[model samples]
Target: MARIKDVAAQAGVSVATVSRVLNDNPSVTEETRNRVHDAMAALNYRPNAVARSLRTEATRTLGLIIGDILNPFFSELARAVEDEAREAGYTVIMGNADERPDQQDHYVRTLMEQRVDGLLICPTAEVTPLVEEVSLGERPLVFLDRTLSGVEVPSVRADGSTAIAELVAHLRGLGHRRIAFVSGPSTLSTGRERTEAFLRAAAEHGLEVPEEYVRVGDFRAGSGRRITAELLDLAEPPQAIFLGDNLMTLGALDEVRERGLDIPGDVALASFDDVPWFNHINPRITAISQPTAELGRRAVRLILDALHGRPTDSVVLPATLVVRESCGETGPGKEDGS
Candidate 1:
């Protein structure tokens, strides 16, 4: 109900003086600033953020578009991003794509229309032309967790090669030769890289993975369940199964339970992303844990650097393997050893 004019009239100062005080301009005397503050408090006046942003041409807000909010990995990443942004005096708007390219594009366009100072995205499998358009435009953009090929945007992602190799080696030590892989869709970089890494590692251990052993899923629980079922139906089923992500791992676990299969006894299990629930689950899951919070912090820093016209570079953090009961490692062993 109160406006700047009301504050100015109450403070007995010019509207320009009120504006300078609100903007924290040092030219205004302390006495005048206190008067303006008192008037504002008395009238319960709130400044219009839209008007301020329009004048400065900076919204002081960032947009984040995640592939799937349902995935615990993305949800944790979002929380970290929000925390880092808030600490840096910026606000964040998040969009959940639910692993759909169309929905991802819609959020991107919507955030752009809202004049977000920068954007961070964990892109979906299908690449939308709008992503390229945004990257080429004036707005600073960064990719998180996942990225698109041929796009030059700066990004922060985990390098899972070493961890995947470690996992395969661990399985080999456990005497699992016929390893099956439930891979995510190959449309995104993480999917392709992870699958490629797993196969390469399996070969290094002198193990052969049949083409039938590799099942591709859409990074959802349903796909995980279906793929696991298919793998179980094979005449010569795999001795162990590696899931691409946490959501799919849940599905695989469900199918294994439905068939009354005992983990590490009937079929060994492992997953890529390590979430909080992984530890409390019946068979503590073995996982390659990415530096998720660090990734979020680094992503914000990259976008802020670009926003301030500073040099920026892409970052690739390494993942570490956490051995647990699910991978048949229950004894006292080194956390980082195979």
Candidate 2:
């Protein structure tokens, strides 16, 4: 392999100049940059990431810990983060925590051991302390999706309450007095926030949100299907169900199909995070679309900013309600902008 010294000799420049050119340092003249590029092309030279990391004390790599890689929301977010990181000349290492504390802890430790330059984490409640310690360390850390309470790490998230409020209001507008809230495990921040928001919004709108009408699942499609089945078997079945996340939404759809229940006709549906298949499905799903791309891009920017010695802070991106056939045209809530 062509080494830096070889490139330097080929380009008739010092090793320092080669380094500057490779790093795209603004101080280097365009003519010098061209010469270095020409030499690199001629020699087929490739920078050694391991060597560069040793010299700079930075791996130029980021660790991404997601709640569930199977979920389209997380998958899309991961893709976005990876794309943005690549554009910024950084590599990404991903881990799926599956929303389990012990698993999450394991991944965090494993990533740290890899000596990643920074982290973009969607923390499980069990790994709160793990995140805190990492944030206090030298590594730049940014929280994505769910964040720990009282721990002031820079984060990017969707406004859960506002999205829930909109979902509830939309249902109410559709003449749904008894709306059920199907949620995931309550231990995570996202689940808790959505549950709290659902209850609060229903109460504010003079709707009775009975405990029996609320069901907590594992945020999986199967969980959604099982919980929806249980809800349907209840003494008082809900007219509509507001799902907390996309995976659960899929489960609910399967349940409806399996049980021969018609969406919007038998039970109206609205969910958070518009997954890619929403539009293509038989009965298109109505959803609060979190800015998935923006979330990933912002997380990358925040991590890079912190690495560059810039101040890091939390950022909550807005959500939008996408009207579709599942909720019908006159769906319950009035979207904030709509």
Could you give candidate 1's per-residue lDDT for residues 1-338 as a string of tens digits? 78777889999997667766766778999999999999999999886443233223689899999988888888889999999999999999999998888998888878877878988999887655567546655567899998888778899999999999999998998888999999998888999999999999998999999999998998899999999999999999999999999999999999999999999899999999998888887788898899999999999999999989999999999999898988776545644333
Which lDDT value does model 2 have at 333?
Answer: 52
> Could you say which candidate leads in lDDT?
1
lDDT assessment of candidate 2: 0.81
- TM-score, every prediction: 0.82, 0.79
In model 1, the runs with Cα more than 4 Å from the true position are 1-56, 335-338
What is the lDDT for 68 in model 2? 85
lDDT of 2 by residue, 112-218 (tens): 77778888889887644445445555567788988787666789988867867877787787788989988767877888888888899999999997888988977
| Runs off by more than 4 Å, candidate 2 | 1-56, 330-338
| Shift of residue 275 alpha carbon in model 1, Å | 1.0
